[model samples]
Target chain A: MFKSSRFPIYYKGHPRMFVKDKPIFWWALKWVHARFIIRELTSVPVAFYAIILILQIRALSLGPEAYANFTNWLKTPLSLSLHVISFLFVIYHSVTWFNLAPKAIVIRIGKNRIPGLVITGLNYVAWAIFSVAIAWLFLNLDNLM
Target chain B: MKKSSEPFWWALFGAGGVISALFIPVILFIQGLAIPLGWIESPNYQHLYQLFGSPVTRLFLLALISLSLLHWAHRFRFTLYDGLQVKHLNVLIAIFCYGGAILGSLAAGYYLWLI
Candidate 1:
């Protein structure tokens, strides 16, 4: 008896079963699901940080005074808080990405596949080295100049 | 069968994920927290300007910004589709996400060139 335009053919005394859409809030109902949701949401903070960097570049293009203003803004509580939240989210993203990398990247040497732990280990090591290199560059920028 | 553009976006997402994971945290810690909080000396304007003036640095920034945005676009598109269950608006979501990333990259390029 239930007939819709999309499903016009209906048997006598038979109605199409109606299934309700899953609510978005369902993701938060379980920790595992929430973690997955959080991982996807990390993109928002990553993109936000990129936009902030773009604005910094724009400030640099303007002149020294403008750049100074921009840096000054960076010192404010609001900027610091935003950056803190973004930093945490980006770190979470990094950890999850590294953990997932082994699954995504399978290496074979003469038909012997590398262990996932080794892949994940290498990712962490590389992350540490890169982080140190960048920190060294920033801390020693004056000396380098 | 028609070619699907999914792979292209997925590739960008993967590259951006690696790049951001490697670089963004330290950069944010230094520029966003350390220098701002006086834990480290903020590089003088002249030094920072000269740093940006280098072609290598400019190229790196361009790559980082562009890839990060592309990564965001790709992931966010899926987030909208699966997370929000707005799969019906697939075409529009794809266009908006990718288009925004492209525009952001162009803007970053323009500003980097200006600098």
Candidate 2:
């Protein structure tokens, strides 16, 4: 598409003009491409969470004793290996989740992209509040039991 | 089936949404029942496993996994074509993407059923 604009060019790949001919737009385009790759790679955590969800279901279906057994085993060295891997996966999932939140929910002032980082940051803030509330509720529940 | 006017990826995305939304809720419901109601003395809460327990839930989960993976596969196919300078292999990539999704979904279903 960039090539279509009819601009007069005398030399085709002449070594003398090479340095001067390179446009700023080329560098900016490459930078944007790299950013897309970064975004895609980081989103692997989203897929990883789906696998984790399946694993949790399997553990539960095995019965209460099996569930306890699984939990106990999870504390062991071998199980800890998987846990460590899953921990990394969970972090990735959370990061991607927050990243996507901005796209899924539009926050606009007349007309705007809403600034992606600002949208992502607000998601983290909301999660923090939710976490505190849940922790408080869980602690109270534990006391009752 | 309709392979001319529309691309296969669109179908996969629609299928995935239908599958995941249907299965995840059912799985949640079955598992949620385990929470004590104070009425039953010894409730089998563990039976309410996520999306893996009941036959019906398993079917939906399998469908979800298949459709979703396929949908993403289609997405990645387009990504490869547009982003990676792989436009020449677009047709091959699209087929592979759909095939992989179907295979993945089937594998998920099989594994869930076996246990």
Best DockQ goes to which candidate? Answer: 1
| Runs in model 1 lying further than 4 Å from the true structure | A1-20
Q: lDDT per residue, candidate 1, A1-145, as tens digits?
A: 2222333464645566553446667788899988998999999888988999899999989998999899999999999999999999999999999999998999999999999999999999999999999888877888898
Q: For each predicted model, how many residue pairs clash, with residues at least 3 apart or on different chains? A: 0, 0
TM-score of every prediction relative to native: 0.92, 0.44
- Candidate 1, residue A74: CA error in Å? 0.7
B28-112, model 2: which lDDT tens digit per residue? Answer: 2222221222222222333344324667767655665666565456556655654564556667887786676566566576568
Query: Model 2 captures what fraction of native contacts?
Result: 0.04
In the range A37-130, model 2's lDDT, one tens digit per residue, is 5444332322333444455455665566766665455456664454445445434434555766666667788876588789888767765565
